[model samples]
Target chain A: MDFFIQLFTDPVAFWNSHTLLIAQIGINSIIASSMFIVLYSGQLSLAAPGFMAIGAYTSVLMDLHWHTPLALNLAAGVVLAGVVGVLVGLPVLRLRGVFLAIATIGFIEALRLGVILNLPITGEGLGLKNPTADPLGGINMVLVSLAVVLFIMWRLTKGRLGAAWAAIRQDELAALSQGIDVARYKMIAFVLSAILAGFAGGLEAHLNFFVDPGDQQYGVTRAVQILTFAVLGGSGHFLGPVVGALVVTTLPWVFQQAHDYINIVTGVFLIAVIVFRPQGIVGRGGLAIVRPAWWPRRARVSAPSPG
Target chain B: MDQQLLNAIFIGSIYALFAVGYTLVFGVLDILNLAHSAVFMFGAAITYSMVVNHGLPFWVACIVGIAACAVMGLVIEHVCLRPLRRRRAPPIAALISTVGLALIIVAAIEQGQTGSLFAWLWVDGPNSVAFPAGTIPNPTWHVGDLTLEASKVAIIPISIALMLVLGYVIRYTQVGRGLRAVAENPRAARLMGLDVDRMISLTLVISSALGGLAGILFGVALSDISPYIGRDNVEVRGLAVIVLGGMGSIPGAVIGGYLLGLIEVLALVVLGSNARGGVAFAALFLMLVLRPQGLFGAQLRERI
Candidate 1:
């Protein structure tokens, strides 16, 4: 209640006090958008965190070693992630559905546990420290990046490329018959998602003082969380995942009253929301509530016969 | 090497048990029950609580824990999968819902302090605990360099017998026929007078029961039980097992489980402990890339 009250009643003070939370929301929204691209293209690829790891490590490493500006560092990270994305995407894009999802899970876990945790440059299990992190100051940049990413998504989804993606999503065989290159479009979406995830990772690295390589950071857990954002938000629309990111990231603050039982509330909320709104919160239908089949219908009072 | 091999087989039994339930649902309904792991942990947690907290005998506690997990499976089917099935929502939606249920179950156990709401369920409050010493009879045996505990040795026979029983039931029983009919084609099964929904519900029950039993064995054998046992121990590894053997293949899951145990042991021996987890996932990745159908799986069918 206080969370909502403050947001509605005193916007300026709320921003000043909850800058970190707001910044996190921005970063999550960006990652969620990255998830959105793959889901929109009918792919259940969960390789976002893997790409994010590459982006994060590359950027942070550059900053630590050469003292490069943040822009150059971010750019290098994004490019490296894209290159890795293409390399990984080629063989992986051959798989579909849950197979793709599992394969990607394997990718992220291998990257985190196999590569990142083993490399001395990545600080092994200890994680790297970013001495020049600017937590509060990075908020504006994050918000701006989110806006730009969303804009690009909106435009892309409305264009010819988006049509090809929608076609492929609906039916790969049918889309192929219609002359759409299923593999190419899937690769495109996967690579684009990687680039965006990489960008989000770079921004997130700037926000925190330590680049932790824990399971919650760049592991399957993070991948699932990002998936939740796209899923809960509605992967059908560009804005749905962003809304999901906002709702999910703010859930802890919103359910502060639940305290230790917050996860229960979150779990119940997730089940209820998905059960009721399987298409997600921001789907094709306007804000209508979906009642399950088991719910009893209201008694219809018949009008008196006019005869 | 002989001792390690013994350890591998012991741990492999648990992995095989856990993956059996995971692959069962996938085989029948083609939906990954992410909450299966939660049921696994819940089984161990409840059994631990029964023995230590409520003074129940270990065997009685085990039965009750397994029954409770069976009930949890029903809840999952009704609350998470059924509604979505009715709505004809995409399979991905089921993933999210099951994840939600998993969260609730884990949290319920994690928050179970002395006076907390879930105190009846768990009282550890997110801490890892083991069954108290002497709660279950555990006698140790030493054969040359190999040291074995009764608890660990028991896992091999129990898991193999149960799996063989499951295999027989799946292959020969009337209920198994119904389940296979449903799995092969739901519409056709319904047309053939098989209750598809019931079969699905039954699948959950059997799967969750096996998962629970596996968890009990794991906790008893490894001497660790917590809200995180499922997550930390077998959640992802379960996936690798099913995939390695082939998704939706019972025999494959069994083989894959032992194979994974062997591989992890081998990785530990050769590449060190740090590479153990990485090696497993790398195997999973390579398996999917080179052979998406797995060893026992039929030709891959795309499902989302």
Candidate 2:
């Protein structure tokens, strides 16, 4: 009605805080979706932040060092990050679970350290500045981009590659035994994940109008947060990360209004989720609310009936 | 050559202590406990508060901090880990949740303490504590004039004693054997009537205690703590040790720690401190590339 008209035509009439909040939502959605690709493939690549760092750096370099067009710079940023992801994944895919987790962490650390040492380009530990505002306009562009990316991701996951990746996640050896090329699937997932993360990073750099090593920590921390969202929403489902992201991102704003007990609240909620309902809010074995047709057969049958 | 080697050993011992805690949890439960570094930092923070604010003795503060760390580890096991185990949570969930726990810890600590207020709470300002810098001021046992410092002399004995005690506990203690059994096969151990959950909790407690010990030592060596001691390169170093030493081997932990420490120190000595971070990361990358299973790890058995 009036809200939709205002949202598109007179969006500026809305409160600045609300606009920023929506922007935040869009940004986090990109991050969550980027992370979901790898989770789908059965890997927890903790180095999402490292790739984000690369993207951010590349964008900054393009803007400052070369003064390139925003579109070109961002494309290059995403591509560079994907290349790095491919390189990192090649060696680490052989590792499983905790080993892969550690390796990815190491990858992040290495890149962060490299940025620190390479002061001439990366601005060293002091961090880089001189960020410009988003060229396509802030909230609108982000919203449009998010819709496109989500649609693309949704389509991708429904295709053959998605099934193959899921099989690899379920059982890598079994997938290989069934003639699925595990390494190629892993690499595709890695590169695709990195590209999305990098794209988000590039957009964020323009949104924030600056980049720094500190921002790398944000990426790393958010990557973990995004993974939490996926798990909390049931990573087995396509819409899991998105739903989880909406809850987690919005929860903080709600808590912010109160200001007190933020950490205690977040900490307790996280603990409860991990302990009591590790399958997550909408997850199987949780509250067997109307079972969606998409719910896996094994999960649906295993649900404990609530008398 | 002598000074560099001694520096390597000094740094190596510290990393070795940190790695011991990380490796113990990995070895016993096959869980990385991503919150471990935060726990380590908490130990140092607790010690700093006790020593500087409460005027407690150093050793007493260290013990109290370690005890608290053990309790925290147990709490994490009870509150976070056990439920996940029962629910058969995916490994990714476990890892991410722990990391979230870490973020919660860091944010809470940051907000509560306002780190800047306590940044200089325990600094020794001008009278810098000194460790033996050179190989020997005057080599009494002059092995070709290669001198050694008094601190260097102490490092070997302390590390060796700690390792031996750890080894003895793991080899002879019933609890230790139960931990090994749980790590090898949780279902089998469960059927054998071992309390799997309790054993896992004990593993976390032991690892946290070791981390606390390392924290106290690191504070002593660095001469300052800012509630951010374990947040930096240490966790990465610890993870590297676990990976490079074989994912779950204690001896591998020690060897990996020392080797990484040596590589880092040598990189610093030759390349400059500015390059140390890069060197540490480069070493980790090489390790990942060369042996994904780690130096002491056997090929991982793929789960059916």
Candidate 3:
């Protein structure tokens, strides 16, 4: 009880205080929402982190190397990321399903390796350091960036492109027959989502004041966590990825606060969701109570040592 | 010139093994098991633990780990994949699930701390683990001017034997015939009273076990084991082998693996270490653009 009280009184406490938890939720919600824009189109991209890396790295490079202003750098990062998306999407969006997945995986891997190869550009994986100023300190910049990107995404996804994305995702053959250019719609989805991801990455880099090749979070593990969040939260709706991201990002933190076995808990959660709740936490419709037969109810709950 | 060629063959043989497993799974299921590399990692780490940490014999450790992967493969099929199949889930769902599963495995291994990557898994590290010189003691085998280590000599012949056995198993066995049936048409196979689910599960199990073996051998040559090594390079090489040889063709995987291996080695010799991975991938990208169906793969019939 004393620990909890002291935590609340601590300056770091506000970041986790019950009242401020809403802010954290809002920030995560934005990232998750952006994820949904791609997942909705049947593209479970593992390149979210890579897009972020691009945004972050480009921002830092432009700011330091070219002496660009913060706002201009941010815009450049988003635009560059979108352009990359379009370029990659043109040839790749033609491939369906696993082929596309593999191609994207290849893209992320190559980009990461490229960064390592060109050490002058990416700081040789040691990372770029302290690339931004505190207009209102570090935390506010993250919140403001999140809000702006989320607003843009929310508006765009609720408009014309979102419906087209839904149509293509539901049945590509039918969508094509109905005169929807499947490839074009997919490109839009990819580019738009990438823009948001890039923006997010830029903010993250500045906040942390460092950027590494590994910083892109395009790693297989992070991709899976993001995917799990989108699926669990309900990709079909606006708030699905938000719900998913919030649960995934924060659950580990909460668990870590109490014990070391966070991964085991998360793994069990993942297995359970896949087997029993494929639609995820915010998912609706039928099969809500029909527990899957394959998933064992008795999960192994063990406390893991520190990572 | 001789050293480069031998090194390529030595490295390529392991790739041949890796490619074979991937091609087998893709050939039969038409699904890319993205987690295949993770399975390979698990195999290496588990085997390493048994041998290095627990003091089991190397061969014993390898066998037990391979068996463990076979079981895990079966479980993956049952838990992650079977539902998708039952509902005829979209290819995207399977792809997403596999990617997610790959992350889960990587994280689980990271949590264990045993499979953490060494800088030299593919990149430069403090000291590249090298097998001691003259450990074999036999005079190096000479193919013209090419000098081959005893271990290197073993790879091609052993690979041939393994491939031959696999070929026989697929061609001569009843289970193989059922697998062929399902691969050709799942619905048709089911209509013919074949246990489609079981065949799919069996395919994953066998492929993952083979992948497990490949990982162990790879660790020996590299003189290191790291979870990060295989995912991209192995997948690209496997896919390239399949594309160049033909998808769903086991013989193609073998031929393509060696061809690719040789090409990469020659390129590395001419180009440099830094450009090796890039050159390999660039060649694959070009191959994909030029001949998507591969040299031997029959063009897939378009679904209406």
Best by lDDT: 1
Order of the predicted models by DockQ, top scorer first: 1, 2, 3
Ranking by TM-score: 1, 2, 3
lDDT of 1 at B184: 87
Candidate 1: deviation at residue B169, Å? 1.1
Q: Relative to the unseen true structure, what is the C-alpha lDDT of residue B245 in candidate 1, on a scale of 0 to 100?
A: 90
- Expressed as tens digits, the lDDT of each residue in B1-304 for candidate 2 is 6767776777688778778878887776677788888787777767766776667776687788899889988877866676676667666556756766776655554544334323332332212232123312322344565665443455567776887788777778887788878888999999999998888888888888878777766655555454455667476778777777877778877888889888887877887777787677767767877877677767433210
Interface RMSD of each: 0.6, 5.3, 3.3
Q: Write the per-residue lDDT of candidate 3 for residues B1-304, one digit (tens) a residue.
A: 8778778888888888888888888888887777788787767666766765566776787788899788878867876788766555445455556655765665555545334342112222122233234323445577777776665567678778888888888887999888888888889999999999889999999888888777777766666666555564575566666666666778878888888898788777887666566565555545554555556656433210
How does candidate 2 score on lDDT?
Answer: 0.72
Which model scores highest in DockQ? 1
Error of 1 at A116 (Å): 1.0
Tens digits of lDDT, candidate 2, A4-59: 45557776674453676678778777877877888889987766777777887898
Clashing pairs in 3: A261-A304, B246-B297
lDDT of 1 at A204: 95
True contacts kept of 1: 0.73
- Model 1, A99-167: lDDT tens digits are 999999999999998888899999999999999899999999998998999899999999999999999
In model 1, where do residues sit more than 4 Å from their true spots? A301-307, B298-304
Superposition error at B163 for model 3 (Å): 2.5
Cα lDDT of candidate 3 equals 0.68
- Where does candidate 2 clash, by residue pair? A131-A209, B135-B147, B135-B148, B136-B147
